[model samples]
Each structure stands twice: as C-alpha cells, then as structure tokens.
Target chain A: MYPTDCRYTREHEWVRIEDDTCVLGITDFAQNQLGEVVFVETPEVGHVFDAGDEIGTIESVKAVAEVYTPVAGEIVEVNENLKDDPQSVNEDPHGDGWLVKIKYSSSSAFAELMDAAAYEEYTKEGK
Target chain B: MVDFAGWEMPVQYAGVIDEHRAVRSAAGLFDVSHMGQIRVAGAGAQDFVQRLTPNDVAKLAPGRIHLSAFLTPEGTYIDDLLVCKTSPEELLLVVNASNAANDFAWAAAQPHPGLAVEDVSERWALIAIQGPKAAAIVAKLTATDLGTIRNYGFATGQVAGKPAILSRTGYTGEDGFELFVEPADAGAVWDALLDAGAPMGLVPAGLGARDTLRLEAAMPLYGQEIDRETTPWEAGLDWVIKLDKGDFIGRDALVASRARPLTRKLIGYEVVGRGIARHGHKFVSGGREVGVVTSGTFSPTFEKALGMGYVETALAVPGTALEIDVRGRAIPARVVPLPFYKRPR
Candidate 1:
C-alpha cells in the first residue's frame, strides 16, 4: 500500500511535498516488482530537470529501470546513503529510499499529478 | 504463466526474489512436473542405454543415478539427462521439459529392438525441495532415513502417506532432494512440505530463481551452453565421456575429438557496467564479435551480473578484456572462471 498524502506518476513514482522542497522515490509496488534492488544511480546535487526527464537508473537482480522526473525542478540533494545501501529501497521506499529532493520553481506542476485514489485505479487498469 | 523454453509455467508463486532467498537461507519447493520422463524397459534395457549415453551406465548399480548426455553422430550434444537404474531391466530417464518430444523421437529412432520406450511425463509429477534445511523439513513427513541417501542416490519411500521416489539431487547445488510422485499425490506432497516447512521459512520457488542458482553453480544449461553444435569437449564436460567403454553412439567422433584440442571454449564473464548482458548478446573483442552469450543473469549471491559464453581458445584466459553488446550499447566485461559463487564448507 502507498501513502495517501503523496501524488503519483503513471510510471509508479511517488512525490511527497514537504515545505518548499518535494521528495521523489519509487512506490512500494514498484520496488516489489523490481525485486531486490542491487544498484541505484542517484542524480547529482544541483542538477536541473524538467517533467519526464531521465534522472537516474535502478538495477535489480533481474533487470534495470530508468527513473524519470515527474515535475520540473532543480535537484537540491540526492540520497547519498543509497550508494552504500541500495537495498534501502526494498526496506523503506518512502522514507530512507527517497531518491532526490527537488526545489520546485513553481508549485503548480505538482497539481498535474494523480491523487492516491486515481493512481490506484490507473495501476489496476495497467495490470 | 511465463514463457520458459516454449512451455507456459509459473515463474513464481509469491515472487522470484523471495522464493530465491527462501531456497538459499531455508527451504523452497519447486514444481518441475513439466520436465520429461521416459521409461526404458526390456531385456536389453541396460545395453540400450549404454549405447545411447556418453556415461558408463552399465557400471551404475541399481538405485543409483548418473548424469549423462545424448550425442549426435558428430559428437554434438542432443540433451543432458539423468539416467536412473531403477532395476536391472528397467531404466528411467529424466530430460529437460522443452526437449521431451524431440528426445522421445530421437530415442525411438535408434536401431535397437526388443526395447520398450514409453513417454510417461504426463503420468508423473516432479517436485524439488532444495536448501540447507531441506532434509530436516522432509524427514519429519517420511519414514526413509534421508541422511543415508548419498548424493545421486535414491530410495522408495512414503511422502505425505503416498509412495514416492526420493532422489538426492538438485539443480540449486544445495543439499536437497527431488521427489517423483504420482499425479494424484503431487498436491498432497506439496501442501505437506509447505506445512512442515512454514516455520522454517519455506517458500514456493519458480523457474527464475532456478536459473540464477544453476548459473552460480556453473552448471551448463542444455539449449544455452550445450546445444546441437556444441560437443562435450568444447563445453568442458569431457569427464562424463568414457573412452574405455564399448561402442556407443558418436563414440568414434568422441574418441577423435579427444585427439584434437577444442577451438572454442565456454567461459564465464562478469559484467562491469550499467547494463545487463542477456542471452544472444554478442561478445566483442579486438574490435569484432568473437562469441555469443549463452546464459546470463544478475547473480543474487555475488550481487553482480554474470554469464557463460563461448570464446575463442586464445581469449578464454581469465581476466581477458571483453565487451558485451547490450541493446546496441557496448558494456565493459571481463572473462572470469566458472562457478561465480561457491558455497562455503
């Protein structure tokens, strides 16, 4: 189950707004589907990105997936702890596994995302 | 259902990784009923098997099993199978799931009479319980002393109150057993094992984990590593061939094969890049493609990508620089020795 307070992208990434900065990470469902995250490539701090841009990579025991930015912003910081412990995503995807914290240039980009209920319905149809 | 060697089978029950960890740390159950089972029974059963396989089956004592291969006239491999000498006049052969029909047709075509060959794959079910704790969990439900059965040995026992053939062999390279039971009793045995092992962290594994485990053990997959074009010598399986044994299929070719060194050899590789090298991927060396990846996967034990591929004899040395083409991108890799991970004693 995912937290209801966050917004989700169609790719299953969740973004939680905290103050002026927003935290981004994969959803619990995404981590489970990937299976045993072995390597995580975190974006560098101070990197600027827009919506739907390729940000980083996540490799599991079977395959690798590219993480994309859901909203346009500047990357203020990356989860440096993931360099030594990528399995943190498998353990806690929402908190310890957060990939990046982006300082948004405009808050309106978050409004374009789906709410928890809509994301659930969307994931059901994709399945 | 997932497409595995042209058969639609479940890749996992709960998930692949969870099932994999269960097998490594505790116990895991696998439904390998899709594998082919054949019965060869007649007065000349022993002679017939000896003529077909590369191993010295005539020396196998009753209640013992030997890993052997069916080869073509040119000494290329047809399939790697387990030959079980159930009795003096009866033998049971277990083959890969996808090669059932093909192997049956090939065996029937052999010029041997008075031999009754029957495909009994549908009548039986195969289950594998593998892990370090497999014996303890299984012993609680069976009367047989599992500790007495050595590797590659078998016994007739009652499992979940049903008669079954228990063999001390597995693909995971763990101390475990494979159970062959009647179709009606398959579900009972599965449920019983799960119940008995739940407290021990038993899980129902699937084909995905099976592939990784076998790769880590450096076991060659039939279609991938040893195919129609690959001879036993090239695949580093010369130990299975018995030159002193009497005449057999491809014996002449195998004898001659020993005289000449293999031009190409199967070697292991560990990818050192951001991409995975999958099967059919090309291995580039010296600005040209030199070999093809047979079986590749991200190893759970080593936490790295590894695979087996055919490389030229000169480049088969360990630490040789190689590149694997993954989705049109060249990823840096190096030739490493086989058995990427070994269990600690």
Candidate 2:
C-alpha cells in the first residue's frame, strides 16, 4: 500500500510534507518498474526548480529515467549517499532513497496533485 | 520478452545478477535458437568459405569449429560468426540472430557455381549449457564422450533420446556445451536438461546475463564493438583475420591498412568513478574527447564497473587514466586488461 500520508504525481513521484519543506522520492512502484538502480544523479543544494522540472536521473543497467520535481521550490538538500550506493533506491525508495528536500514558496503547489488513495488506484489500473 | 531483431526473447528470467552468478557458480541454460545458421556444401565448399572470411577456414578439420567473421571490401565487419565443419564438402556458419538475413544475402550474392548456400535457420534450435558444472549435467543425458570433446570440437549423438549435435563452445569464459537440435526436439531437450540439471544448480538465463558474461570474457558484440565503420584491427581482433591467406574479399584493403599505424584502438576499462559507463558514453582525457565506449556494464563477477571502448592508440595501454561522460557528469576511469573475469582452469 502507498503511504496515505503523502501526495502523488502522475509520473510516479511522492511528496512527504514535513513543515514548510517537503521531502521528495520515487514511489515503490516506480523503483520496481525501473529494476536495479546502478546510478543516481541528484540535484545540488540551493538549485531551484519549477513544478514538473526534471531535477535528476536514475539509471539501471538497461534503462534510464528522469525524476521530475512535484512542486515549485528550491532544493534545500540532496541525497549525497546515492552516488556510490544507488541500490538503496531499489531497496528502500521511499525511505533511505528519498531524493530531495524542497522548500516551496506556497502551499498551492501541492493542490492539483493526486491523493494517496487516488494514486494507488492509478498504478493498479495501469495508468 | 523483448523484441530483438524480429525475435521475441527474454532479457532476464530471474534477474541479471542472479542469473549471472548462477552461470559463474554452477550452470545456466540458454535458448539461443534465434541465432541464424547457413550451410555451404559441394566440392568448392572449403574454397568458398576461405574466400568469404579472412580467417584460414581451410585449416579447420572435420567436426571442429573456429571463431571467424565476414568483412566488407573495406575490411570493416559485417558480422562475427562461428564456422562449424561437418566435413570437407559441407560446413555450417552460425551467425548473430539480428545479422542473419544480411549475412545470408551477402553470402548468397557471391558467385560460387559449385558451392551450395542455404539458410537452414528455421530448421535448427541452438542451446548452450554453460558454467563449471555444465558437463556433469549434460553428461547425464548424452551418449557422446563429453570428456573427450576438446575445445572447438563436436560430435553427433543421442541426447535425451533424441539425435543432437553437441559442441564444446561457449560465450561465457567457462567450460560448456552448445547443443544443436531440431526445432521439433527443442522443447523436449530443454525440459529434459532442466530436469536433469536442477540438481547441479542449473538455471535458465537470458540475454541480460549473456551480455554481462560475454563482456566479462572480453568477447566483442558485432554491432557495438565491431561495426561497419570499425575494422577488426581497430577493435583489437586482428588475431582472427588471416591476412596472408590469399585473395579474400577484404585482402587488398587489409594489406594496405597493415602498413599504416592505427589512429584509434579498443581497450578494456574500469570506472573508478561513481557512474557505470554505458554504450556510446564518451571517453575524455584532459577535457577532450578521446574515444567512445562500445560495451559497458556493471560486472557481476568482479562486483565493479567495466567496459570495452575504442580510444586513441596511445591511450589504449593499461593504466592510462581517462574520464567517461555518463549522463552529464565526467566519471573517472582507467584502461585495464581485457577479460575482466577468467574462470579457474
């Protein structure tokens, strides 16, 4: 089950809100589909991105996928550990593999996204 | 299953790492039926093959096999294949699955009046049982002497109550057998081998693992390592090209090439940096592009990242430091010796 505590995007990323800054990572479903994560290129600290901007890329042996930001914000912190240990994304994409922490300008950025329940059905129905 | 050259094939069954280790540790079975086969026969069969390939095909005895390739008039690779000699009058050429039609068209276009060229691809099914325990498992089903079949050797015998041609050849750097059976008997042969090999830790592997295993063995993939734009000498596969053999298709071009020094050469490398260098990744030295990776992967055996690529001939030596642009970042790498993994003999 997807965590009911976070919001979701159509591109398979999750936003876990913690105070004014929210943590971002790919969903469990996304990591499973991508297979083994051999490399991760994360955004640097203080780099600002708008909603739906591709901030990073995750590479497997056979494929590579871009990770887009869910909300408009400045990247306050990036996961530095994933550079050498990218398999953490495959093992625990929701927890240890959390990609970035964004400090958004306003709460309106998360308004149009799908809720946790809606996102679960979206993945289950192959959307 | 993925679409590979009009053939539906699995890239992985269990997983790449799991299937890869299975072959390295015990044994793994592969359904290589998609690989194409062309048979040539007649009194001129030997002479025809000699002219078609740069290798000295006349040196091969009956019931033996040798690695060789077909080249363009420019001395560039058309495809790499295995030459299997059934007799002096008849022989088979097993080529890459994707290159089958092109290879057939190339050979069929040649004017050899006495030699018969036929595409027998649809009639044959090829299976490879590879690893340390492969022989033990295969020996349980076949009547042929698995012990006496020297490397690059083969024999016709009954395996699992069916007629089969078993050869001592493999892409993995391990002792193994490649079984050539009819399409009708492929299922039975596969099932029987699975049942018989289960005890010896044999598992069904796929192309994903095959790519890694072959790369670790330093075997070149035709499309990437030796393409139409690259010659055998540039890819460091000059050993297979017999230049002294008279009047092959690429003879004149290769002879002229031998006099000049190579501008670029293929070398093995390992990434000491963060990212795994992939195919087409740029190799840079002092911020200038030096070469490009042909085949790269995270080697399961060594638990490190390695690959083969063409670079400036001066930078092809082992211990030369370079950078590979994987994604947008330039990751550090170093030229290393070929065959990143070698099984204990």
Candidate 3:
C-alpha cells in the first residue's frame, strides 16, 4: 500500500519529508513492473539536480528504467546498500529501497506533487 | 500480456529471473503455442524441401529433425526453421510466428509438382517443458521412451490421453521436450504437465524467460541475430549450409559468399560497466562506430550483463576491448566466447 504521508509523481517516484531533508524512492508499482532489480546506479551525494532530471537508473534482468527526481534539490545521501543488494528495490521499494535523500530549495514543488490517492489513480489509468 | 505476432502472450508468470533460474536448476514449462507449423506432403516433398533450404534434407531420416533456413536467392534469410521428417514423402516445417504468413506464401509460390505446402499452424499448439527435471516429468504422462529419442528426434504418441507429436528438442540450452498437440487438447496437456512437474519444481514460464534462456545459449533470434540482410556465413550459422549437398535456392549465393572474406562476424560480449547494453546500441572503439548490439540481457545464470552483436572481424576475437553507447554514455565491454552459459553434462 502507498503511504499517506508521501507525495508521488506520475513517473512513479515517491518523496516524503523527513526532518530537514526528504527521502526519494520509486513506488512499489514501478518496482513490480520492472521485475527483479539486478543493479541500480544512483547519483553521487552532493550532486545537484532540478525537478524531472534523471537521477538514477534501475536495471532488471531484461530491461532498464530511469528514476527521475521530483523536486529541485542537492543530493545529501544515497542508499549505498543498493550497490550490493539491488533487490531491495523489489523487496521493499518504499523503505530500504529509498534511492536518495535531498535537501530541497523550494517547498512549492512538493505541494504540486500528487498524494497517495492520486498516484494510485494515475497508475490505474495508465494500465 | 503483450501481443506477440498477433498472439496475446504472457511476458512472465512468477517472474523472469525466478523462472529462468528454475529452468537452469529444476524445470520450467512454457506455452509456445504461438509458433507456426507448416506441413509439406506428397510424392515430391523431399525433393521440394531440398530445393528450398540450404541444409541437406536427405540426411533427415524418418523421425529425425534438423535446424535449417529458408533463404532468398541472394542467400539472405527468409526465415530460420526446423525441418522434421515424419517420413520420406512428408515433412513438417516449424517457422517463426512473426514470419509464418510470409514463409507459407514463399513456399507455396515455388513450382513443385506432386507436392502440397499447407499452413497447419492453427490446427496445432506447442508447449515446451525445459530444464534438468523436464524428462522425468514428461515420462510420467507419455508412452514414448525418453531415452530412445535423441536430440532433434521426435515421435508420435499420446500425452495426457491426447494425441501428440513429442519432440526431444528445445530452444533452451537444457534438456527438454516440445509437445505438439491439437488446439483443443493444448490446455489439458499444459495442465497435466504442470501438475506432474509441480513437485519436481516446474514453474509456468513466459516469453521473458524464453528470451533470456535462448540468449544465454547463444541461439539466434530471427529479427535480432539473423535477418534478411544477414547471410549465414556472417551469423556463425555456416554449419547449417550444405554447399555440396546439391543445387538449392541459395546454394550459388552461399558458395559465392564463402569465397570472400567476411567483413563482420557475430560475437558475444560482457558489459564491464554497471548498465546493461541493449539491442541497437552502437559499439565504438576510439569514438568510431564499429558494430551494433543485436541481443543483450543481464543473464540470470551468469549474473552478468551479456550480449551478442555483429562487430568488425578484426575485433571479434575474445578479450578484445570495446565500448557500447548506452544512451549517451559509453560503457566498457569485452568480447567473450559465444554462449555465456552451458549446462553440465
């Protein structure tokens, strides 16, 4: 189930505010669609990027998908465990599979994102 | 589900990596009914088949089968097919689903008296059970002696109380059987096989696993590895060409192609970088485009990104360094031997 506290993007990324920074990760639906994760390439910490920029790549056995940032921010932390155990994305997309943490420049972008209910509807329509 | 050559096929059931590993360690069942079947019968069947393909059909005795190709007069592939001889006067040609209609038309256009080439695909359904435990599962439901049928050999028998043509052949690099049954009995046969093989760790697989399995075996896909523009000599399929077996449609062209040195050769490669190289990705050396990837995947068995592609002959040797342009980033890769994985004998 999608967490209520998090905001989602149509591209299947989810972001949740945590203290001074927001954690970013792909939604459960995206991980299921991509199958088992064989590898993940995350942006290095301190890398700055704007909204909609491709911040990382997720590779499955048969295909590859790009993960885009949902807000303008500088990457503060990346889940280093994904480098060795990429299956975390498929095992627990919203938790341990979190890709990066960002310190954002604007709170306005966060409000523009969809809530959990809206994201579920968007994915249903896409089906 | 996805439309594959007009047939709605599942891309996976349990999962690609799961089913792929099952096929390598235990067993996996696949519904391959989308493949096309063509029947060639009558007095001139053998002669007509000989005239059409590059392989020597005379070597295929009754109950025998061999892989061959239907080629244009220019020696390019029309389709790669499996030729199965039920008897001297009758043969069955299994063709790719994507090229079924075209392949049937091409065969019918040839003038061969006392022979009839008919598209019999709709009347049949194919199911393949592959992996180490496949034979044991098949033995429980059929009267056909598993040991009696050699690789590429087939026999008519009853499977799950239905008429079937059981062939000891498969596209996967593992020991397996392909069951050809009537369309009405397909469901029953599939269910029976799954039921019998379940305890043995057989899982229902889909097209996703099928592709990865074949890629690991280094088998050529029609649109990817071999195509209308590619000759057999260039695809490493020269073994299928019988130049001295007598006059065939592409004999002269194949002989002529063999006379010249090949400019490019198909080779296997492993990506050394983090990303997986995909089909149509350009292979570069010193910023010069030298080749293009034809098929690539993260091999579940080898746990590495492996691919096959056509590269300049000089760079086809193993250990040669190359780079693939994945999107805009050039990823490092190295040429390896064909067939990234082989089953233990």
Q: Write the per-residue lDDT of candidate 3 for residues B110-176, one digit (tens) a residue.
A: 9978788899999999999999999999999998888998889999999999999999889889999
Q: What is the C-alpha local distance difference test score of each model?
A: 0.87, 0.90, 0.93
Give the DockQ ranking, best first: 3, 2, 1
How would the candidate models be sorted by TM-score, starting from the highest? Answer: 3, 2, 1
Which numbered prediction scores highest in DockQ against the true structure? 3
lDDT by residue (A23-109, candidate 1, tens digit) is: 999988788778778778777889999889988888776667889988889999999899778889989998899999999877887
State which candidate has the highest TM-score: 3
**Stretches of candidate 1 exceeding 4 Å from the true structure:** A1-10, A14-24, A42-55, A68-77, A100-115, B1-10, B13-18, B199-201, B251-260, B271-276, B286-288, B325-332, B343-345
True contacts kept of each: 0.37, 0.26, 0.89
**DockQ, every prediction:** 0.32, 0.53, 0.83
Docking class of 3: high
Candidate 2 vs candidate 3: the DockQ winner is 3
Q: Where's the lowest-lDDT run of ten residues in candidate 2 chain B?
A: B243-252
Residue B13 lDDT, candidate 1, scale 0-100: 76
* Candidate 2 runs further than 4 Å off: A79-85, A120-127
Per-model TM-score on C-alpha atoms? 0.85, 0.95, 0.98
Q: Write the per-residue lDDT of candidate 1 for residues B1-345, one digit (tens) a residue.
A: 678667677776776667777788898898888889889998989899999998998899999999998899999988999999988699999999878898988888887688898899988899999998899988989999987888899999999899999998889877788999999999999999999998998888988888888898889899899988999888989888987989888899988988997789999999988566778999999789989999988787776788999988889999999999875678999999877766655
The alpha-carbon lDDT assigned to residue B229 of candidate 1 equals: 97
